[model samples]
Target: MHNAQPWRFRYHRGSRVFEIRADLERAMPHADPDARGLHIGCGAALLNLRVAAVHEGLHPETLLLPDPADRALVASVGLTGAAAADSGLGALYPAIRQRHSSRFPFDDREIPQPLREALGEAARAEGAALTFPSSWHLDEVLELARESEARNMTDPGGDTDLARWTRLDAASADTTDDGVPYDAFGPRKRGGKSPMRDLAGLREVAGRDAADFERNPQLALLSTPRDHPEDWLRAGQAVERVLLLATLEGLSSSLATQPVEWTDLRWALRDPVSGTGHVQLILRLGYGPEGPGTPRRPASDVLEVLP
Candidate 1:
């Protein structure tokens, strides 16, 4: 996950089909040994592609893991005429560019009920459920995040993925077309109760300031009925859907996967009473400064055309 951007596209012009594949070379072996994160990232990209296609008045019929034998082949979308295009998804096209993972402190502003319901519906549309943790569950989730962050800081192997994908210097931030840049890391957590992962753990940046994050952060847990590659893909789509809707609703958002990264903590993240769904992501949403846009590889670099 560390902004590795582990995905690629192969478009067949004649067929008007887009093949989404996992870029295994960019996979985080240490952080995501099972390649689950890779699939989720690919799934998010797939959702974006669908949104773009719909916005351009095209209908996309998506098939996940179409080739079972080819594990890296995450998804394939067959594009057709606009007769069956989804206008709802097309409306989210503008939010695609506006949405960014906000890492800065969010003020203690509560999201309204109707907007929350709309966001939840967005997730459900993609075959996933988004639940705002109860007060008790929120505490537990925050503790798990703290525990995971501590382990990552002390464990020699934990920092391996973060270091590889984080640009601590201005020069690298300017040159690299991927990875989280120092400017996007936001201010250091001087004091707060928000369960934010310190991406810059033990690494200092020249002018990074410190600020107090919100004492009570508005968090939502994204989950599916089961845990599998297909489910991960659905969760990814659901997550992006929620994010885009939130962005359009004037909310800033960030993702916290630190707790979800640890196996035991991940299990504990599930709801205690129902205890059914498998949590795929921990989302933080509120009003705050939107994170600076990180560099993205050019489409030409990630996409391929075949005659």
Candidate 2:
């Protein structure tokens, strides 16, 4: 319900499996025409389903990118006979509804070591890597953010889409209720773009205190071995998995796809020293302020029951 929640599941009572599909109509043409973002978003929903299944006292087995004929159909999750319940997973389910993307400044305090380790464990359970950038690595990421801003500003098509989605006029009821609204946008840095708030390009509309911008926030990167629809979906699942864990641990988080969206800059984000694969998202994780919830379409709008 936070942002894009495009998923249609078919639960087969005979096999005890849940089939997951992508709803393309919910996709963003200009920003994510290829459906990377949509797959990722749907992937997150799939993760929620798995967590819910586990909470019901079942072990879940996932098949990624299961059918080539049905490209939109991402995966099928089957329940194993193991009836053991994971208290760790049970702890996170409560936070799912409470978790929203907070774009505002964090408390500017250091993240504790134990919490960072826990976040990593959460992502690992979903087959992805969540790594924090070192000082030099963080600088590399910021440079890419600058590049992302410049690219968006120069590309009229990209700029137009952003403008249409970012709602700065909090009073404007005419805006689309699906994406980031104006008020939820945080402040802009001295010369940087407004962190690509869900809206296209209204930095001024997305409110923020110039004095509260984060200077040295803890940045985490979510990466997958390959950059495919399945991988994007896996990354998305990992994104929520880690975010939910952070929330339960009393932490706040925000996501930045700016660096990963740019092809050349994205390559630069991979550390030669660490030998990791491509980066899917650049996340800001730490003790900080949480932003308000964005709007979403109803469950009936996105879910379809098929025979």
User: Which candidate number would show the highest TM-score if scored against the true structure?
Assistant: 1
Query: lDDT per residue, candidate 2, 208-288, as tens digits?
Result: 554345667688888888888878988888998998888888888888876666677888888658776878888887786
The lDDT for every candidate, in the order shown, is 0.89, 0.73
Clashes per candidate (backbone, < 3 Å): 0, 6
Tell me which residue pairs clash in candidate 2.
Answer: 106-288, 107-288, 162-200, 163-200, 166-199, 167-182
The runs of at least 3 residues in candidate 1 whose Cα sits more than 4 Å from the true structure, single-residue gaps closed, are 83-87
Q: In model 2, how large is the Cα lDDT of residue 129?
A: 87
| Residue 303 miss distance in model 1 (angstroms) | 0.5
Instruction: List model 1 lDDT by residue over 194-268, tens digit each.
Output: 887888888788898999999998999999999999999999899998999999999999999888888999999
RMSD of 2: 3.0
Model 1 vs truth, CA RMSD: 1.1
